[model samples]
Target: MDYIGWAWLFVIVVCIVIEATTMGLTTIWFGIGAIVAWITSGLGFRLEVQIFVFLVVSILCLVLTRPIAVKKLKIGKIRTNADSIIGECVKVITTINNINNEGTVKARGQIWSARSFNDEVIEKDEIVCVKEITGVRLIVERKK
Candidate 1:
């Protein structure tokens, strides 16, 4: 009803918008704090008390719940479409001799430059698992 209440409402809306845009979990805590401050203002609390309540509640929410929320939200390995190919089996289209610096692999229907992870010479058509990626090259190991 008062200016404090309006200000807190604005904060809540802005924070929510930022959270939705980035999905980074950064400002939702401030939104929760603004809600508490809005309610405090509605209950006729002084401006200083409202602000204090907002800061304390916001910090508490961030410190107490953020880690748990992040862990729970991470249900499985988070990977982009390109990164999802890591650990997948691929066929060596070209000989992968780390010493000779020649290697290529066909992964996900795309030819990618590759290197042997253990420095072993891998001949063409051998199946290898992608271990990691560095720059434009796939680090690969023999598939066990």
Candidate 2:
């Protein structure tokens, strides 16, 4: 085979390896283009023509298929137990006085350090609804 054919084979192998390792739609199109270029070279196409076809085919495949492939393979965020706690009510185990920056609560049988959402004082034993979580601290507001 000519140098163009060897180059095409090399490019095809490299692109396939990259696509296999990443599985991220990064280089599979290049592999397809390399295959086309290899076939064109074998059919007696000029080196320049082979290279041009390779580039055009690679770009076309990538542009036409990438978005569709990505959309089909898209993954959604995985929810966790902590994500279920938003808006849940819990009883204060310690006074919630954001002015003093002290608070604790019991929810789902677990104690969580907490703070009042609006900095208002929440007495011990008061019920509060979880608003959000910041690091390990739960931001809460008194349940009306």
Best by TM-score: 1
Taking the tens digit of each residue's C-alpha lDDT, what string does model 1 give over 1-144?
Answer: 877789999999999999998887889999999999999999999999999999999999999998888888863446567778898999999999989889999998999999999999999999999999887899999999
Residue 43, model 1, lDDT: 97
Model 2 lDDT tens row, 1-144: 888799899999999999888778888999999999999999999989998999999999999998888788872334468867889999999998888888899989999999999999999999999999887899999998
Instruction: Tell me each candidate's TM-score.
Output: 0.73, 0.62
Supply the TM-score for candidate 2: 0.62
Number of colliding residue pairs in each model: 0, 0
With candidate 2 superimposed using the best TM-score fit, by how many Å does residue 41's alpha carbon deviate from the native? 1.1
Q: What is the lDDT of candidate 2?
A: 0.90
Deviation (Å) of 10 in candidate 2: 1.5
Q: Flag regions of model 1 displaced more than 4 Å.
A: 75-77, 80-89, 95-102, 120-137, 142-144
